[model samples]
Target: MVVLNAVIEAAGLEKTYPARDRGGTPFRAVAGIGLRVERGEAFGFLGPNGAGKSSTMRMLGGVSAPTAGTLRILGLDPAAHGRRVRARLGVVPQDDSLDVHLTVRENLLVYGRYFGLSRKAVRERAGELLEFARLTEKADERVEHLSGGMRRRLTIARALINDPEILLLDEPTTGLDPQARHVLWDRLFRLKQDGVTLILTTHYMDEAEQLCDRLVIMDKGLIADEGSPRELIERHITREVLELRFPPGEHEQVAVKLGRDGLPEPERLEVLPDRLLWYAEDGETALARATAAGVQPITALVRRATLEDVFLRLTGRSLTD
Candidate 1:
């Protein structure tokens, strides 16, 4: 079993970049963030695009120095002991930067060499990683010949060449199909079971729910909220959600009417292009009340609360937005 000691700690972390124009104005990508990640816990940084998730991950991975504040990874300063800290960390960036000219196994071997591993060790590790990543069958195939999911898995395997104590993944399954995503998730789950500390950034709420033990929601360079998926959902949203679809032009009128007089002014309300979301503590009761109040919807659905509801309630925007 993995120990529960804090492996990563950051206090008042900040990162600001100069503006693109001649004005030299500063753009704060991350601001005053404090976090502690325990060893073997799967922690997630969740936010929409441009919400500083990537920036925070970069700083914690020791690839980018924070503009201010202190960070310690494995009790070592990330800025001062970057090389040493990196040796014990695995990083899988959003973009697959594998060498297309090299075969799958070759890519792993080359990255191992960069870490100063001897040829014999690299070869043995490559074989093991290929099996772990399920790419053993394609070991001799060039990266360019592999599918997107294959390439992504290869990148993940390459990151583990050093047997890192920490694994950092940025959008691990961003563009994969459902089947491919499940395969990746299975691999990640296995790693978690093997006592690997994982830190990831993802826009997919379901992914976070499935993998993270806890997560921070970021917006506009600051953390909006932090908790486990279930905790956040319970705190920020109701137990059930009712979705309704009205006829095309009737949405606005329906929304207005609902806002003016709905079932006890639901916990939260959202009007979408073709539907409306009525969040309430009890879905059946709310639906009954709405129906009794002469509000008729073309279609309706009642579902359990989810992390997406929490994110929307907190940020006032969809995760994709």
Candidate 2:
């Protein structure tokens, strides 16, 4: 195994796509971002759609080349040694591309064979991966008959056929139900516990908070902030958030009224279409003050600050936006 402090390193990485029309301006997807992800660390990329997270992942996975700057995977330049670099990396793309005609176990066996493993070795590894993915009971079923979560787990199992040092997952649980998402999260958590370096891009705030040891928030192809979940919240957001939902089209008016010293002013006030987020160290106190000042809302909620708040503050948009 290759041993390195930083399993993945990039300096001023960038990716640009040429415009389709003859006279149109080109679009730069990844705008010169730099990052260092260490071995055995679960690092994440958080961003909305078109924020270049996928583009960055493609470059890091050695599937796409950077338009400019340097990137080193396992201390080897991906541009120069794409094959060797990819051999040690496991990639789970945003969409599952399993061969539906194959049985669940067949999928793994086929992929393991592609890596040139002997028939006996591939069979053994496939058995272990099926259990790890909780698909042992369904091993004989064709992938076309598996549920969404089952197929997702099978995809992950397929990626592990070679026992890669680093696993890259792009939007791992975007379409799953709550229970399915948690089950997948458990599987991912186990991989991290086994000391596999995990690099993932996720739009789910809670998913990022649960899986990422450290993460960068990207917007418009740039890194807005980078830190642990707790650190980012403490740095860019208050300790608590008071969500006040007023009547339709009245939230802005309520925010204006609250800002005129009608209550204990929050550290920051964000006016959204359906609600007003009052950021404060003590949300209960702020809520009390709002009540005393007769700032009645259709509904009110005071909750501890979360990674979603930090993402919203940084990108000025929801995670799915």
Model 1 Cα lDDT, one tens digit per residue, 158-188:
9999999999999999999999999999999
lDDT of 2 at 189: 95
Which residue pairs in candidate 1 have backbone atoms (N, alpha carbon, C) closer than 3 angstroms, thus clashing? none
- State in Å the error of residue 220, model 2: 0.9
- Whole-model lDDT for model 2 versus the true structure? 0.91
Q: Which pairs clash in model 2?
A: none
Tens digits of per-residue lDDT for model 2, 1-321: 856599999999999999989999999999999999999999999888899999999999999999999999999999899999999999998899999999999999889888888999999999999999999999999999999999899999999999999999999999999999999999999999999999999888889999999999999899999999999999999899999998899877777777734435338888888889999999898888778778998889999998888988887887765
Name the best candidate (by lDDT): 2
Worst 10 residues of 2 by lDDT: 257-266
Stretches of candidate 2 above 4 Å error?
1-4, 260-266
